[model samples]
Target chain A: MNYIKAFAPATVANVACGFDIFGFAIQEPGDTVEIRRRDEPGIVIADITGDEGRLPRSAEKNAVTVVMLHLLKHLGRTDFGCEVVLHKNMPLGSGMGSSAASAVAGVVALNELLGSPLSRKDLLPFAMEGERIASGSAHADNVGPSLLGGFVVIRSYTPLDIFSVPVPEDLYCTLVHPDIEINTKDARYILRNEVSLKNTIAQMGNVAGLVTGLMKSDYELISRSMVDVIIEPVRSILIPSFNEVKKAAIDNGALGCSISGSGPSMFALSRGIENATKAGEAMVRTFAEVGIDATMHLSGINDGGARVLESY
Target chain B: MNYIKAFAPATVANVACGFDIFGFAIQEPGDTVEIRRRDEPGIVIADITGDEGRLPRSAEKNAVTVVMLHLLKHLGRTDFGCEVVLHKNMPLGSGMGSSAASAVAGVVALNELLGSPLSRKDLLPFAMEGERIASGSAHADNVGPSLLGGFVVIRSYTPLDIFSVPVPEDLYCTLVHPDIEINTKDARYILRNEVSLKNTIAQMGNVAGLVTGLMKSDYELISRSMVDVIIEPVRSILIPSFNEVKKAAIDNGALGCSISGSGPSMFALSRGIENATKAGEAMVRTFAEVGIDATMHLSGINDGGARVLESY
Candidate 1:
């Protein structure tokens, strides 16, 4: 195939108790990338959409192009070139893994056009390169789930160990993205550099419990275990109406709720789509009551992360 | 059943990645306690053995007596009394959960002598009181597993939530108790009160991975995830020949090795008794080379925590 189109889903990272380690993919509000082979021996961002020309045109400045560059370099296909187009369906800096979705779509499209030279797992480091360029830190919590789909755990980063965690079919996700921006770097900086041993142990216990709860499909345990002791307490202040939104979600039957990724967006989990819908609407209403515009999406766990649309 | 005898197994707390939250029971080298109903309205430590009279006979100072006092108080059986005897088969201050075993046995024997007034789950808080008397902190990492058997995860401490984690039947444990004493308080004091966010995230990742490994019965993942970034780095320095003993255990096919609890005892996990036996021997030899006498025990996960013994 000489050309390919791909779509990658957005993801919610941190997942309450599992900061920097747990995340899961959502089916709606993602990004798309289209790629075509070029005679020139260098990558080019030929066109872009939905970003209002705010993103850079330079290949090095864009997460999608950066991933393509890394992927080609890793494949020893530096002599090959591609013309790329990015369609940003997800809002930027909204903590819905916008950069990760674009990066995953770019590599997935390129991989398909090149006849699938790299496995899905092999492309993680390249996508991580995109994250490094976007956030100044190479974190796989978003990109891993956006690439592999469903629940993903970044087991370790130094040696790059990632694994897929099973999700119960009945579990549904509710995401409320407020009309505000919170940079990932700024959110991370607001956190304490050092956390007490007592808090750390409590955090570990909750993380372990969350994993076990998910594995066992025990919803009560999931609700009880979905607590963040370290990150949310500090970053929640940055997001407007954070407390009210969380309270609304919980009151409307959410199994759990927390700031998704870094902020400006909140995510909740519920056992059924009906409860998820109600929770999502409550979060939106809570934000509206606080004079903040918000949008909500209800989705089941995304089983397919990034995939080719159609080959030509 | 006016008089009852019981034995509780030793436990290895921390389990490398789960400091203050995870522990497992071992079959050998435990503590024995005997209890007899009395008409007098107060608990008493009538006799003691194997501790060289180092322990206090006062109920407020002794872990065994403290557990009995708490148990009776909770049951509103303060009008009832028991005469107790403690036989410490495990060494004192060896980091082999010596105090937790005594506490567990005391509660078990008293429950039996009272015609099983409290369920097994109902007895955790009283055992935690024993831990509080012994370590000055009410931690369930050791006592939970000693009472619940197998691997136990203390999900929370505020409300006292503990759960049993599945153990693979093929898994065997190797423990080496060196002839030295490291006070739990002193060992804990050496650790940093605050840990960096980077290390805490890594710790959370390993803990989640370890739980997943145990649930899925993935041996390789278990080996890879059985790592500690927060506690062992500080505590290992207090244990003599720590590095060499760990190396010997790993070299002999142990899945992982680390200081069992605070210090002076090290534990390793392996797939079979043969590997566990070899690893145990290597740990002993390594300690011997360092001029520290040690005793090794090879055992599987204790499926039964504490049980009533036939009385003479």
Candidate 2:
């Protein structure tokens, strides 16, 4: 019997202000995980590439492999395994959910290949475990959006609260990658252990305003509320021209622009494709102006995360 | 012509966990402002009650009078001079929107009495101004919900992104007003100026969850997210049996409970009026067990801040 195939898109983690509890997926720069049934009845990750030097081929170090183990353990099926292939589509270390996107693709594809035994809701914990393997923390911010697509808010980490927000059809995302690499562990270490009360309040208000901005499709509010008082500043130092690129995207009519995931890549959201293209180009130009060469991609929110493109 | 005859509810400021922004109205207890029309286009406030003679009855020292003046100035009209009598229905020095609720009522009443030139949205700034006179800081946490009648999220103070959440129709707010009072200024001072980044992240996660809870009508999520790590401990100290009552309310099927305003009063929200009644009675009972007498009232979201009761 031929098993199912699934593809999970790349996710943007950290999400500017929300740290580990908020994220969204873009249309381009995603990973594909192909899973096929075997005489074995568990989950397994077969191949890894594009991150040969960085990723683990032994399945123990790979996030996707670990999550599959977690899923099988949770289901009381200790002897379940499947041959999985990870097509590393996006850059290895581009701050665009390079690890999480791959992890999401793994678990989602495996779940579907298992006759869709577990629903998407049920797949969240397994996906979160995959994230935990990569960053030493189980956070759903990136995993949720990568698995579900569009904007997602993660309310909890232990037991994940993942939900999708309605993305207006007109909204599009512009991404700029500066070909720079910043390890997630290094980015996480740069932040302070404590934050000022004033900053915390400001961050909360910004989060609130961002929600309203997304809900009302108010580009101006979205632009204004994208200001992060916490993670980005401390982490962005590792990425060259991060601030300049953000400013450029905003000046180019993007609603709000900020560093994607842990940095080196910046994403801006705009009202339509035209604005999104302009936003992408502007970020690249600004990065170039700062002597940093960057690649920009403009795309809209993908309504579905993983599905069949076609079967041969 | 008579300018006005009724009063508006005093808003409880500093809604728990939503410090500096978020408030709700109490109908049983309120501030009554009586207005009398006069030929001169000059404002006058007379006979301020329940303030222990500490308030200025002569317009200048009175906050509501100043807010009324703000409304007139905002409208660019000089034809609103009238005699304003404020009957402070709720207790003075209570952690409520004693001044803001009055301000909201006077403006709402005056706006209706004066042929409704300004809108409901226009009244927020004036109410905030009224709060500033008492608290010495221009904040919208109290007046926004007071005027709008529901849960509110204030995105920022400088830009003033203030709006209300469409509270679920099934939600019931049970309020417990203890005899003891906590000064708002003192409550504000007692709070720790610095917060840990970990706590702040947790708080932000809760805030995000709470917003989603209200939108999705997920009472469990709302209850889980209604936690405060920054201000609640210090503020709750001023309120008698705050913890016991909150525990009792939660045990009795109330979704979640927290200090209503600054303190001395706490509220529990539940899925239905029956649970709200049980929760309200349980709160009062819990307070009695601790030798603190609290008058608990079961009420729904006002939905009407300061509307005409009979328009005679």
Candidate 3:
């Protein structure tokens, strides 16, 4: 195939008690990337959409293009050339893993265009490279889920151990994105370098409980385990109407609610579509009451991460 | 029944990565308690064995007697009287959960003697009360598993949410109790009140992985996840030849090795009895080389926690 187009779904990182370790993919509000082989000796960003001309066209500066460059280098296909186009359907800095979606889509499209040389797991390093350039840290919490789908756990970073955890089919997720921006770096900087040992133990317990709940398909256990003791207390301050939105979500029957990744975006899990929809509406209404524009999306857990849309 | 006897198995708490949150019951080296209805209206430690008279006989001072008192109070049977006897088959202050076993046995025996007024789940509070008196903290990591059997996760402490996690049938546990004592109070005091956020996240990842490993029965994942960065570094110093023992266990094909709870006792998990036996021998030899006498027990995960031995 000479050309390929792929779609990568958005993801929610941190997952409350599992900061820097857990994430899950969602179905709506994702990015699409298109790639075409060319006789030229270098990759170029030919066209972009949905970004308001704000994203850089230079391959060196863009997350997707940077990922493509790294993929080529890894595959020893540096001589290969391609024309790339990105459609940024998700808002930037929304805590919905917008950058991860784009990066995943790019590598997936490039991998397909090269006749599928790399396995799906092999694409993770390239996607993580994109994350490093975009977020100033090499974290797999976002990219792992956005690429592998379902719930992903970054078991260890030193040896790059990542695992795809099971998620129940009945579980629905709701994301409410307020029209505000909170830089990932700033949100991270707000956290304390040291955490109380007591809180750390509590967080570990909850994280283990959350994993068990997911594996057992226990909604009540999930609700009880979806608590953050170390990061959310500090980072939630950066987002407008954070507490009110969370309260609205819980009041409307959400299993649990928390800031999606950093802030300006929040998400909740529920057992059914009805509860998810009501929780999303409650969150939106809470943000609207605070004079903030918001958008909401309801989805089941995304089992398929990035995938080829078309081939030519 | 006028008299009842119960046996409570030993427990390995903390489980390396899950300090104060995780534990599992083992099959050997436990405690036995005997309870007999008395004409008087107060609980009393009528006799004791295997403790060399180091344990207090007063109901207010002894963990087993204290648990009985609380159980009686909770059952609105303060008028009820009991003569209690405790046999400490396991060594005290060895991090083998000696007190938890005694507490569990006490409650189990008393509950049986009262014609089973309290259900098994209702017995947790009494066991925790015993723990509070013995360890100066209301931690259920040891007591929960010792009473409930199998693997137990203390999801939360405020509301006392505890879950019995599944244990693989073939998994074997090996514990080596060295001839030394590390008081739980001193061991806890040695811990740093604050932990680095990076290490905290790492610990959380491992805890989640360990839970997943237990659920999925993945031995390699359990081996990789059985790591403790928050507490073991400091507590290991209190146990002589700690590193050598752990290294020997691992070298002899242990799936994982770490301090059983605080110090002086170490445990390892393996998939087969052969590996467990070898690991146990290696641990004993390592301790012996350092002039520290040790005893080893090899057995599978105990699915039955505390049970009535004989009724009269």
Backbone clash numbers for all candidates listed: 0, 10, 0
Give the winner by TM-score: 1 or 2. Answer: 1
TM-score of 1: 0.98
Model 1 misplacement above 4 A: none
Q: Candidate 2: deviation at residue B69, Å?
A: 4.3
Q: Which candidate is the best by DockQ?
A: 3
* Full-model lDDT for every candidate: 0.90, 0.75, 0.92
True contacts kept of each: 0.84, 0.54, 0.90
RMSD, model 3, all Cα superposed? Answer: 0.9
Tens-place lDDT digits, model 1, residues B36-154: 87888998888899999899988778989888888888888889987888999988888889999999999988888877888998998999888888988888988898988999999
For residues B3-99, write the lDDT of model 3, one tens digit per residue.
9989999999999999999999998888999888889899888898998889997889998898888888888999999888899999888898999
- Candidate 2 overall lDDT versus native: 0.75
Best candidate according to lDDT: 3
Give a tens-digit lDDT track for model 1, residues A1-312: 678989999999999988889999999889999998989888999999999888999998888998898888888999998898999997888899999999999999998888898899999898988888888888998999999999999989989999877888999999999999999888877888899988999999999889988888989889999899899999999987788889999999999999999877899999999999999999999999979999898899999888888779
Instruction: Determine the backbone clash count of candidate 2.
Output: 10
Query: Model 1 scores what on Cα lDDT?
Result: 0.90
RMSD of each: 1.4, 2.8, 0.9
